[model samples]
Target: MIHRLQNISELIEVSSRMGSDINLIQATGGNTSIKIDGYMIVKASGKHLANAFSENIFVETNPQDYYYNKNGDIKIINPKKSSIREGDLKPSIECNFHALLPKKIILHSHPIEIMAHTMLNSFHSKADLALKGMNWKYINYAKPGEALAMEIAKSMKVDNNIYILANHGLIVCADTVKEAERLQSNVINKLKLNRRVLKDCELESLENIVESIPDAYLPNNKIIHTLGSDEWSLELARKSAYSPDHAVFCGIYPLIIKDINQDWKRLMQGHTYAIIEGKGVILFENSGKYLEDMLLAQAEVFARIPVEESVTTLSINQCKDLVNWEAEKYRKKMLEKLVK
Candidate 1:
């Protein structure tokens, strides 16, 4: 048992180091865990990785012995302390999934480039293609917590070391923390290399239209002006474009509008801007600007990467798949809002 805890301590150090190195996780956006004996030392909920060195990572009840409630939430019972019960130091909202993974070391994160791809419905096949021959599984999207964990446990095959959480992030597991980190780094590097080419563009034509929109949305209008000319728009319309995932969330095709009024009308009709075409994306009150900001922020992250680094490009068919998925999600969200 003493040796096991020592091993777990080493695993935690490796996990924390990798999390810091990857740029995917900032503050507390990701978590890591190591299984020791019957217990697991998971990154404590809401703790930043930079501060997640040796002492502060919390020690909770053994995950193996945790019980499920009627609602499917795990009821963690800490045997060591009389006061420490199920609800103390709320387990990670994703704790159950981490608990169920068969690997001794587990790491999960929402890397901007990866998240941009995963959030789009079109990229599933692309990811499958990229990861072909690798030991992995892709799980459909599910709400976080016990339900997700249950699904992962059931869907994951014993031979797979990685699980791509649809619309979420990636999970890599291995016998050792170093192996898992290597796998993650390799995947990220491959994705970067695959997306290096810039889709052809000619931005001289949309100068007038770009002038009218609010400045808040046009952080880099000079680039937009250079890339979104009428001729550029027409040409881009004929060809598929590149973006890590904007094509998936907003749609594969740019909604070319000659005027702000037309742009408003299209948005009112429910359309999003494509990254390649520089058509501004629209957000509805029901869907909220938060989700829109997330998408744009993801795009900005990709934009910062050098053009030579992004090798993969989304196909036209993949773009259509994302449009259909986002449309369905929007419909469901609108329906729920109406109900409320």
Candidate 2:
């Protein structure tokens, strides 16, 4: 275990750097892990990657013994079984996948570019052309945690090193930390696609509407801008959420304000932002950076979607499933805790 101890700093540094990139991970949406000997070190639950290196945000575990409880939920295996350090923080819900994979390092990210492709109905086939140089496994959307790990195990191939979780994100595994970083870079470079840029006029128009709303719902100091004034973005906002991340962070669908006469109180009850027809989007008071990032991500996903292809958005039922899941509830609670 001496070798593992020597590499702990590297693992923390890499994970912290990855978290610092808003394009790769926003808030506490991603996780990283390292396995050495009989122990596995994983990002603690609800902990931001940006804090990985600065704080004791990692938990060590014995991966060999894990199982489900009577309620069919996976127990938090060896949550307190640690040799490196101790804390009250919980391990990431994704620790199951990290433990299952035999690689020395595992990095999972909800990169907007990668998720943009995965959110589409044609990701499995389209990704082939986009990432032709590397072998990747595309797994359909599964509930996070054990369910996701099970699907990954079933889909794992002898040659593929990357796994793209549909409507979610990407996972890369490698025998060495340097190789893992290289693979992630390669995937990002290959998945590059053009996106629509909102012009100054479009942004000003949205700001005008936002300023007009005298209600407390719209914040005056915060930035006001449309994700995109393009047809694709507007259309995407009209549908149900495209992924669990969207469903949880944003809302099931954006509330479109066709007329200012609409009941503002009722509309903003559970939602954080609203889209105004022929104007733009307006967020609630003190919406903060996390909500803004999610809106931008939503816009990017829509912009990258092929005009001819019909995207596969989360169904109402599926959206409900995600919102009602205990894991998501805990994550949301933790996010709220962090914000405070």
The candidate that wins on TM-score is 2
lDDT of 1 by residue, 167-223 (tens): 456789888878988988777665542332333333333334445533313323332
- Write down the worst ten-residue block by lDDT for model 2: 219-228
Give stretches of model 2 more than 4 Å off: 1-7, 67-86, 197-201, 214-224, 286-289
Model 1 residue 218 CA deviation (Å) reads 12
- What would the TM-score be for candidate 2 when compared with the true structure? 0.86
Give TM-scores for every candidate, taking all chains together and pairing residue i with residue i: 0.54, 0.86
Model 2, residue pairs in steric clash:
none
Q: Judging by lDDT against the true structure, name the best candidate.
A: 2
Residue range 183-285, candidate 2, lDDT tens digits:
9988977876666553222656565566666442432322233343455567767889887777878778777766766666676566677777655667776
lDDT of predicted model 1: 0.53
